[model samples]
Target: MRHRLVTRGAVALCILVAVALIGYGLAQAMTTSHQQTVQGTSENSPHSGDGTKANPRRTRLEVGLDGCTKGWDDPGAGAQVFDIKNTSDRPMDVVLLGTGDKAADPHHDPRKAQIYAELEALGPGVTRSMTTSIEAGHFHFSCMPEDGPVVDGTDTNVPQPSAELASSLPSPVQHAAPATEQELIPYTQQYEEWVKGQLPDIASQADQLKDVIQRRGPNWREEAQSIWLTAHHRYMTLGGAYGAFGDLGDSIDGTAAGLPQGPNDPDFTGFHRIERGLWANESPDDLLPLAQGLSNDLSSLQDQDLAVGALEIGLRTHEVSEDIATQTLSGVDDFGSHSGVDSARAQTEATQKLVEILRPLLADRMPADHLTAIDQRLDAAQKRLDDASAAHPQTAPADLPVPERNAVRSQIGQLSEQLAEVAAVTDIRRAT
Candidate 1:
């Protein structure tokens, strides 16, 4: 459902490239301690940046090969701002976690620790800030560099608030302990198998589209369009496995977003390309080749290893709906077919499947009511989509009534927010 094709391998390479760029840029900016204070703001000053009335307490922590959380002292409870500076030559990711009673030493087993906030890809000699409100608890900072093992800062104990202070302090931030790679592997593997199961239907629909194009009988164009929609919808249900498909996916469903020649690019071959040709009144003969190519790609996809990364599986839980709301509903991904809403419905189906697959893992980690709310939100969004499709079978999303479109968007936006927590909870954390 993404505008451009991006694989897990590609994403890793990009991060490595970005780290190299940051190292090169900040080659001369390295310094010792890296501790700098804000001149104007005191620890007790009320900060309105994040719309909270609590005073902002600032602390600096150093991250590098030598140590992580170098200068951190025991911080007090309440609103806090941490300036995490990367002192190493390589880029690093930093996570602020609340260690529950499960682990005596938080760093030794961080998977059980709940994440309050995190900053990713903090470059060398660069200072990145994270603002969060904390309740009295055991907390620590974990720093992971590009090419080294995870390093942890000293455990910080924020004393419990007194009765009077508790009444005045903000509520504790909501967080969940992250899952480990081993814990997530089973779920990812299950999801992978489910994706593999969908391939048969997708390939079959592609074949149907090609057959309709080849017939060219009376009303054949309309029939071809319908078959194309069916095939496209089936392909879209594979939303969570997008990155796993990699370039093959691009060849099957990729849009012409980043292509040099746009839609005219030679590489623009897939469902969208076929959609354009069919809806733009191109000859059936012209579309047959594209349809054949799509079928071939789908067949090829079945043969590949089709492994879904654990991290990517977690991320796709939120991203599938996000792409639907941002790209599919917005019509940015629509070629000439004007089937954005239809595509969104298919993607919603994908989201539902992803949530179902991860429900076992999420049950204990997430609040019961939170999981129920997600289901309710997803059902509400699906009902709206179903109603829209039944009311106007072939209309564009933008051409729909404003109230209908807004209702769908509102439901989807809320759903995306709820799924974001799922992403956070299922994120695989590094353990020492």
Candidate 2:
């Protein structure tokens, strides 16, 4: 009996040893599999924990303003983004700089840093963003508050750009040769003749409107107003010619805001005067002479050989868009008529015409992407204007729904930003 019990005990020990060996084997396999998985994950990761990568792209760089915080991360060039926030109670102008050795001293100031991008004139609590490509370099940020000390951050002494960053920088844009006098004269003359052709139609419509005002029939007032709006649209299309039009341009389209006498000023003439009269329900009898005078002025405009400066005309592609945003989109251009949307459309059409005329010159000169972006934004802005007009057929532009108004404002802002680059693309210049 003792011998049998001893043998059973040995068997039990063997079974126990077998169980321990199996468990150890399973654990070892699991550990090996886990280690393989971890190694694979590390190798496949796009960016390593050390911040090195192939074509490292960063999220938008946040800029804090209003004496709160001033800081930025070096995005290491390629296309970068900036989200500028104004936390203060006043306006702030934030600038993004790519500094060189010259910027180490504060006394050198603005000249030391090359301003790669800027968000100028942000109202209190406003936030705006800009997307631009930069060459890899030492970079920092500066914010100038309207009512506080300039807040600056990030180490000013940035290290030398990496070789990868330097390689990613875009080649310098090759500018188009400036249009010579011989080339400019014909284009300018053709554009001027185009302006002259539109004036006769403007004068003719003004005459018809004047006649309707004189008739004073029940429907004559409406007919007259319709003619006036039509005439106003035609005149707006000629905005590129305004620089050459001189004082006559003001007499024909000037607003009352800056004038000492205001809208009631006798000098506040042309389309706006007629608009005030029509909207205010002023006596049709009183508006007759104003319409006749507008017609006469328009007729005179056709006879004049208005010589425009080449640079002035070249700059109009950008300047027209700027004016539309500042004046028409703001609803100041047609305060009485509430036809600001129509005015914007007119300006856009004129600018597009100018684009077509200069397309050959612009082909390889400007960045194709910029031109394409301008077209897309302009189309979006036009759609927004159309939507506004359709949604509120009778509502004045100033009184449109906040959403619609915001849409218009946002689209116009983007469109203007793209348009602003046109002058530089065409090698356009200010007068010498």
Candidate 3:
């Protein structure tokens, strides 16, 4: 009886262990199956319903442009991908802007609303995509007026879309908003008139330079150089009106980069040309034509119906410092004269003037303390230039020793950072 009882107990223990092992294997299999299902869904399935796929929701808008067509008749607000085609002969750039509050908030642009995205320099017959997220609101599309002449064997003109279709296009603001919210058209007109008033001073300076160049006396070069500096500063003062100048601006102050051969290129016209001639010790006669060309360009610009709209006026304030960093401090602008600091001084002073003009408008948006600090920074930068100038008489900033040059560069860099904030604060962007 004892042996039988032991045998039964062993069998029962074996049976119990077998059942436990079976249950554990079943559980493991079930878990593996579940994990496989999840992995399959994530890796194999298209448009996984759980919102795990990359760019799960993408909206596409087909855009077609030519000389005649302007914008999409129907625009939807959301995250959108714009596939734009340039059907025109010339290269094109496109901008889509929201009608957000056009106030002086760095985080916001009231008139332009908000910038969705921009596609720039699209070549003829080429297609490109621009993706941006936008809020539900009014929006408009603009193509930068094409640059240069139309390419041969390509259509320069396209039939205008039907009037019904044209009417569907969103209406752009006829004029830029004022610094104050008082009047839009009047404010823009007033600014335009002001731009007109300033042109004469530039012309007069150019005329003085022409006279100095014509004299060719014993000190003619010195007199002409000094007058050229004055004229250059005066022209820079018109930074507020840069946009309105358009091609004329290029004819007046365009750099050599645009030309194939750079500085030595025959196409290299404007103030810098004279600068090269003067600094290279070229004869006054050799430089006279360049000087005369500059004077003539100024006079022509004076007569042109140029205007500094509200958009450009605000932009000039920030671009001045930006130019300092990219051009002046980099010593690109002073390749001929080596007076990069002088150029910087003139640019900064003019930019300061622009800031002061816009201060009242800016005051409403920016903290007074921040504005004061910017002023102080500008002053400090100017003082550094002054000190360096005093220390190194008859020496260009480019010729300064490395240490002294670095010290000046550091101050200018600091000021540039602060100046950058002004654009952000104002929410200014160039018109496409």
Candidate 4:
């Protein structure tokens, strides 16, 4: 009897081990498969602008189906089927991602923000529809499980689905009380109007700044020197300080949202040209203060934007303010470059003022995570500053020349990028 019992126990243990191994293998397989999909393609799915008003898409967002063609219609609610077919010679899978309550960042937009369904392994011209559903929040549709050009049985560096979409999450909000079309329509329209107002303003500003730098007349040198750096700086800060979350801090499903769409649209190759001109293609040093100022200004502008919409923007104005303050102190300690500290401090002060002016817009909307991240960046910046301070001192605060200037401006540019990424991660207002 003892011998028989031992044999049974051994068998049970073996089964459990086998099961565990299988589960682990599946999880890894899924992860590897997803990565293959992300890095595999650089093409944008074509969007059809031809959907009829008579059958307008009631869905919050429609993916995979074209607005131009009649075959695909918008989804109303619940799980939607997009009949995505890869008529192309290759085989591919469609991976679906959801955005619960997270607002889409205009920059670094969510993967789902793309117009067409995610296509994987399609040969030339083959067509198929992908099926998906809408949550009251944001979502993404991408091609997944791709068996791409492989080497050594390994698909080199294909990116998997981003962290936000890898899981199938339960909807946190009650769908029965979904935000009505009436409420969202007004905000959407308002956003469009606000966006249109800036084109001329941006062009005019860029032109004026460039002329100042070229003339090297009056204060033009200083202004011209800083123009490109400043604009990029401001753009970065505008990007950083906030992001959209799915559940606005309530649900773990919250992921960063859309890329910037209005003046900040990355697709606007024009901005890049404009950006390059601000520096005149020279190195970007004297531009630090200017760029930092821009970050401060842009952050302020976004705060103002939320106020216009009654969007209940979160009150994170001071988070960036505090970050700037903390870094100035550390920079003073480490670099002995009072110049960097002085400049950084001045820009931060502007950021602080912007926060104060826009505190009311935040109301109850901002999430805790957003606030926390800004502080983290500030803390990291301080470390950099402190390290600079403790190093062997340079003879004199060097007047920033082109090459040196470019280096500083590049740092400012990077700083701006961080700010924007944070802002993108935290701008989570929904259709409420």
lDDT assessment of candidate 2: 0.58
Ten contiguous residues minimizing lDDT sum, candidate 3? 24-33
**Tens-place lDDT digits, model 4, residues 1-432:** 000011333323332232232111001111111222222222222333212222212222222211111122222233333434332233444433343333434443232231212223343234444432333334434333234422111111112333454243222211111122343345434433443344345434545554564455666545654554444333323311233211211111111123266323432222232343343543344333333343343334433433222231212322333333333223421222233433343344334333333323222223444334534544554444334434422211233344543443444333433343222222332221
Q: Backbone clashes per model, in order?
A: 0, 0, 4, 78
**Candidate 3 accuracy as lDDT:** 0.55
User: Candidate 2: where is the Cα deviation over 4 Å?
Assistant: 1-183, 428-432
Better of 2 and 3 by lDDT: 2
Q: Put down candidate 2 lDDT per residue, 206-227, tens digits, no spaces.
A: 7888888988998876787788
Measured with C-alpha atoms, the lDDT of residue 166 in candidate 2 is 59
Q: Select the stronger candidate by lDDT from 1 and 4.
A: 1
Model 3, 47-92: lDDT tens digits are 1111112232232332233332232433433334455555545555
Q: Pick the winner on TM-score between candidates 1 and 3.
A: 1
lDDT of 1 at 197: 90
Query: Model 3 reaches what TM-score against the true structure?
Result: 0.56
Candidate with top lDDT is 1
True lDDT of residue 333, candidate 3: 60
Best by TM-score: 1
lDDT of candidate 1? 0.74
Model 4 alpha-carbon miss at residue 272, Å? 26
Q: Rank the candidates by lDDT, best first.
A: 1, 2, 3, 4
